[model samples]
Target: MYISLNEILKNSIFKSVTILAGEAGLNRKVKRISVFDCPCNKDILNRNTLINGDLFITCLEQFQDNKDGIYDYINALIMTKSSGLLIVTDDCIDTITKDIIKICDESDFPLILIKEDVPYAVIMDTVNQYIAIENLNAINTLKLDKIMYGSVSNNEKMEILYSINPNIGQYLRTIYVDGGFDSAIEELKTHILYLNSRDDIFVRSNNYYIFILSADDIKYLKHHSDATALKVKEFINNPKVGYSRIYSRKDISKALEEGKRSLETAKTMNMSFQEYNPLSVMQLLVSVKDTQEAHDFYEAYVNAIRDNVSAENLKEILLTMEIYVANSGDYKATGKIMNQHENTIRYRVNKVKGALNMETDNIKFNETIAIAVKLRILMNEIFY
Candidate 1:
């Protein structure tokens, strides 16, 4: 829910700052900023001076007389579970020694040095503002989350949602990413595809990035899924994504469920992304996998069609059949992909259909076999 030091240090204001040590602990969350104006010593670093998750910003004036006080300060930071230290160097203490950097690295306490010219007010403003906005987004996301996933009445949910985005139309859509992160709320904020004007709600829950986009924003993605997917992968590292169809506010639970189920389907199918369709063949493929149902369906459709098949040509025949089905029953294209003659592919396609006592011309035949082909793959009927 809090912004990590790693996130804040990315600001342009911190670009001039040097990260001296403890690069590994950059993900530590910053709950507050502590500016050290008072003398820093063991007595001052006691429990009363700081709490957990405090990031200390100091001028290093206190340590000018005894610069090794940096060691005691760092040890105190580790003991109290503080976030890290940002030292603004002055004339008296213009740089940190290697020994202190080693201590910071060993203790996993971030040590930073900044120019004395960079105003503390600017640093505090930049870091604290990031903290504030991130905290606010987290709060709003949680509130809407309760209204969405919790058992709140429809009127109340609508009212709260209206408060956040007055233009929240009849429809809302969700995108779920399996990329877990601490400060994902900013993902919605920073992405070019998402607009602050749109009031998108993003949150990290159960190690997944869940965000709800308004119907207006869904316009960009409804039919341009590939483009949207490319953009998501561009930013999100090709994560396993399940995006829901546009649905009403009352269908929030169903929308989230569709996203979850579609993501599951993508994982089971070894795909990077899936868009949920209630009547999709993928939906049917996912539904019947529990217990002995997959085996039963495979036996009735795939194995039945698979009967009288030779063990030697089984791999080729199954591969050709899969290509044919994926190409929408186009034997010619399937042949091109398989680098075989169209006649050969058509014969293999008919041989499978003829065994099932069906013809290629029937509309439902393609749908039926599509399910069977996917089920065959899902059940691992063939070695490949």
Candidate 2:
């Protein structure tokens, strides 16, 4: 971000400077600083030499009592789109007139009054430093953008990372944010800077903002998972977010794909965010369509339950089966998930077996039942 007049006002050298007018334009970016000394030379205000966003500092010595001359000068600065004007009074000019302040206020142009005791050299030095820093930040942002999404080779990526942070280690998580207003995106960036101690890098790709975090940082976030998730949901302005599993920089491309898939899942389920999981059978099955083959598979295995069980009981039994399979057939774990006793879990398992007419003890039959349960759930979602 470029330095603004508000930032300049915060400097110690400008602490005594009073804003004569144009409070609305304090946020105007100052690209460069120029000393306006030639009061008689109107040609100096030409667009070729004096560009927009230039901050002008002047003493108005030549136009000491010529109010019209001063008015003409201020008008020229406004026409050239100068960011702001700082006038050193008590040197050659006594004070700015109400007419000048009126013009500035109407134009929404920044007008600052500096005491004559404040030397112009100090203002020049401070503003130049700010400009230099801004230029460096812009260059770094460009490099980061190329590294994240451009067609840079692996060797180039390594070199860029080394240049940015020589001690850069593995990036463990990729956070992808999709769909938000530009202002919301800016707010999210500000929040990320606050949370990551301003060490995180951000880049825009298509419709998403991608953030890569180190393993230790990811661990810290997971440790404060509840608070972090709440902060994200609150600050991101309702964007769909996807978080990928741990991965090294070498696998960034794959990690990004995982994040995209997770985002798709979150959008389908109307969730604000989702973490990628490699072992989620429901997530995998949800990708299947209600085709003839899938319907046939579901019927062949789950027909008895679908035909005989009530709708509410069918939902409960399928949910129980899903938890059972997800927990590797650990009935106690499934019971905890279902908020029931182990005996109740056993009763449900027996009901499922009787309905399917299959032996639960047979490993092959159990596997088939798991697959059938997943397909049946997916079909319900598709058709219902």
By lDDT, the best candidate is 1
Cα lDDT tens digits, model 2, 233-348, are 65566888887776676665566667767776676666787888889765666566357877787776556766656776877877777788879888999999889998888888
Model 1, residue pairs in steric clash: none
Best by TM-score: 1
| Residue lDDT tens for model 1, 1-384 | 787898888766676777888989999999999687666566765547788899988877777677776667777788888889887864544447888778789878898877547888888877777677667667666765677578888777777767656765456777777753333334634532333545455555545766666554556536444455456665565488888887776666677677777877877787888889877876767767664977775567656555757777766876876788899888789888989999999888778777677765666667667776888766667543
The TM-scores, one per candidate, come to 0.71, 0.51
What would you estimate as the lDDT of candidate 1?
0.71
Candidate 1 residue spans exceeding 4 A from truth: 41-49, 159-279, 283-307, 336-343, 350-365, 375-383
